[model samples]
Target: MFVKITNAGGYQYVRLVENYRENGKVKQRVLFNFGRLDLLKNDPAFRNIVKKLSDIVERTTTDNTEAVTIESEEDVSDAVLKNWGYIVFRKLWEELEIDKFLKERATRGRKIKFDADKVSFLMTIQRLIEPMSKLRTYHEKNRYFGFEEDIDLNQLYRCLDFLDSIKEDLETYLYQRNRDLFKMVVDIVFYDVTTIYFESCRADGLRNFGFSKDNKINEVQVVLGLLVDKEGRPIGYELFSGNTIDSKTMVKILRKLKEKFSIDNIVIVADKGLNSRLNLKIIREAGYDYIVASRLKNASKEVLEEVFEQEGYKRLDEKSYLNAEEIYGDEFKYKVLERTNVIKDEEGKEFKIEENLIITYSSKRARKDKEDRERLVSKAKELLENKGSITALEKKGARRYLKKKSKTEEYELDEEAIKKDEKFDGYYAIQTSKKDMDVEEVLGAYHDLWKIEQSFRVMKSCLEIRPIYHFTESRIKGHFVICFLAFLLQRTLEYILRKKGKEISSERIMEAIDSMNFIEIEIKGKKYLIKQRTEGGAIDILNVMKIKGPKNFMTYEEGLGFIGINK
Candidate 1:
């Protein structure tokens, strides 16, 4: 409880009271305001007496304060949270041997901005890569964040410009080691393609209007293909024209990576958008094993016939029924059906929307299918009802009345039903290509593509990867690179928190960091200390990661730990 005290001079005083009950008896205490107590200097002794009395009165308040101690989930101070991404980036940068990797490239001098070594370079990269906020506000009260108001804003812009120049160098740095970095225990590599809409419609070199996935035909967009390792850290990314087909992209990116990085012996995983015959051809020709969402309809007639002829594939709820058991090399088996539906619009031209039933040998796929079936049943029933209504309206005597028509009379019908055959509920034909793998494992691998889709959601929602304002090629690249980095850092923090079974969002982590009040407190004339007040949960997370106090902030020595740094 808070109480306000006012003097004749209009000065206000605030006091806090704490109350508790012990053994069915109530206790009350009061705490005088520090600044307010000092202001009552006219009667020094009397003021001192009042303060002592207030302290005794305040004993009850301390009881509740001591009862619950908040925990610090992570040392997510503004500087730490903001720079945490840079730390992980530096780690991956060194692991991938980006510096030595860059030196070998003949075009290194062409992009002088990226080729050079500057502390600002890494810092700038870290800044852009930070999660999305219109303007960065980190540790404003902490002077150590080193934001000097006296410094010209031009200098900050220069830093941004310098960082923007090395866009390609940064890409090459990460791309060159794509495979070697994941040579060990790399179980899953998620691949995804998404479009970023731009403000301008004019097509330059790389920017063009294609299929706007966002349904914006007037807006020019670019297609971005990204690859991430099992740990959810980004490995590489490629930018292509918006019209670029997903199926055609994998081979080009893979070929570029194979030639540039000298990589082999890796599994390529993608969703249905990338499951093309030509793409599969390239995957096979390149000597790379791939797990793709097999298009049953696209399978060869011989393969489909083989699948249909195999009586073992039809077994259900047994080892063969949409469940996993060892069959192929550490794999499982399941069955699925390709489904298609015909549609006629206002013009009566027929088209079809093909779908698939992805049976799985694994529980993951089964659960997904179960949920999908539930949702589909709900939607399909609704659609059928809506279509039934339209059919009923067309039948004679179905309507209650008819509106006036200049030269026509209307007829109505009762109990009219749709004319379409319900037997067509299930349609289309196709089969899986994974003859060697179990059906469950194949479905599981294919559905895992959802992880990449989730990543795109984070990129757009958390990082604001779209709605780019910059028009120059360098600025455009810089903007995306930064958004990516921010995502990387945000994901890293979430990963660490999850390991401890604690849940906190990247935005909340930032909010906790912001809640901190860093005061330049002077206890006495001669003693000064910088105090950081954060909850206990936040600190616990930070301690587990060995990031505590002011000392853990990155130092030159830590940066030197990265490969090929010229300290």
Candidate 2:
């Protein structure tokens, strides 16, 4: 075959001409026409073809000197390429001893056909790298270099069932391991709750409609109560019915986690959502201290009168001062209001609970408060203008600002309510039982609550924990267990990096894992592996794991060894 340039319809075209002898005479015919030459030159695929041709020719000269390899560029296209980035996570998984735990459980149960440990590993790794449904994860087994298709979709489901069976054991095992190995901090832990909603509206014993943190009012969901140590390392988690209130789950989680793990002198920290008179009483009665945010908007008339006093407030720094552009004092200030309240247990016995409500104000927080209020106001006015037949019954968000006129059903923006809300802007109050602790310590503990919140984001977004499709309660709980393990592994890697001075993110770690691809090519009869060079946080991870960097070229045995397939 030969390439020939010809003109057709006033356009220059490239053609593949093949020559052959039929009877006694030789004849030539065009085999294929590659459209216009100019367009073909600009096409990416064509450019790739040219580059591949150039590369193979150079390689044939270079590689043929050592072995019979790479017959053509088509051979290169026929080679298998897959993500081997999981090698990093695999090491971490084994180090956590999850494999040993699952295998031991498998031995205790009836003789199962499939490997629960392997399937669980598959699902957890999928949750870390790219979360998907169980059936989808089964189908994507070949997407990894060392992964095999020994287990089917049914096996993955069975693994979840087994995981549900040993959920508590697994949690306890991890808690003990972390405490012993990492010196996991339990002196003070942060606990928070978030709702994971399902796609279907069908309710079950465990899944029902509740006050969704996700604002998924129409969807059925299950509340997840997560407990993390001071450093944000997960201690354990619990799943409650969708109707379970966030505040109600607090005492239950704290009490159980403490008893199960033998946590000592644990002080719990949480947001205002879990801050209630009853919760505080139960916590105190259980011999645990709590630092929770107090709702400044819910203050009584006398409390507000005392909170707004300027006599005891202190400025942290002069950085908040404004020159010529602001009115009142914009410096960040804080004041502690001490109060004693009697909290009673189930026995009707009352005890005095002393608390220091740390009230803080800042110009930056003031700006954000104003912006958020204006946004709500904008949405409120639009709601009023379009308030056709919708009954405004003082609902959440902007609707709370809409008051009904007198006894009539008609609604309008309540200026008084707006003014009252604005008065609390830039002001934040934290109620803590630790009266002896300094102000900065109290604020610092409250601020670390974001780490637990960030963990929820990791579960919801990165791990895709919601929109659950499982109908059975065990499956739902098991799915959460898998997601929790994935999140733990990711956080463990991040913690390792933080200690090593890298300070990488989970998203970046995922990207780095994704970029570690390897090409498996067959040369003559033997196979060879070629790794694509990577320059990302994956390098840091591989180094931290004490593994050699992937070479440009490796034998099949070396590739399998590198992926840790043999042992």
| Global local distance difference test of model 2 | 0.78
Per-residue lDDT of candidate 2, residues 1-567 (tens digit): 566788879889865454667698887664334557877777444433333333433465577554443333233323455788887778777888888988888999567778877899889989888889888998898878867658888888888888898998899999888877777767778989999999989998999999888999899999999988777678899999999998889767866766888765767899999998889987877788889999898887877887778778886545333331142245577898889967776789887899888888867688888899889888889888988734635567778778888998778888898898888878888998878887767777887899999999988888889789898988888898899889888888888888888978878888888778775655455666667555469888888877676666677778778777422
Q: Write the per-residue lDDT of candidate 1 for residues 1-567, one digit (tens) a residue.
A: 344454435565434444556699976443333335345456333333344334433442366632221122121111121222233334444455644543454244553333323223243333434333223322221122222223332333343454466555665555445444434345446787889898888887667888877778898888999877655666667788777877667866786557754556566677777866556556655766566655554555554554445354443445444233432223334456554434454577655434344432333443444565445445444544455443433212323222223464432222112212121122222223334455445555655666677778777765667866666676576566666655655565666677777777655665444433222211112111222344435565555455434422123233224212311
Best by lDDT: 2
Clashes of 2: 0
Which ranges of candidate 2 are over 4 A from the true structure?
1-66, 69-77, 317-330, 345-349, 389-392, 407-409, 565-567
Segments of candidate 1 deviating more than 4 angstroms: 1-144, 147-188, 297-310, 314-333, 336-441, 492-537, 550-567
Candidate 2: 10-residue stretch with minimal lDDT: 319-328
Residue 136's lDDT within candidate 2 is 90
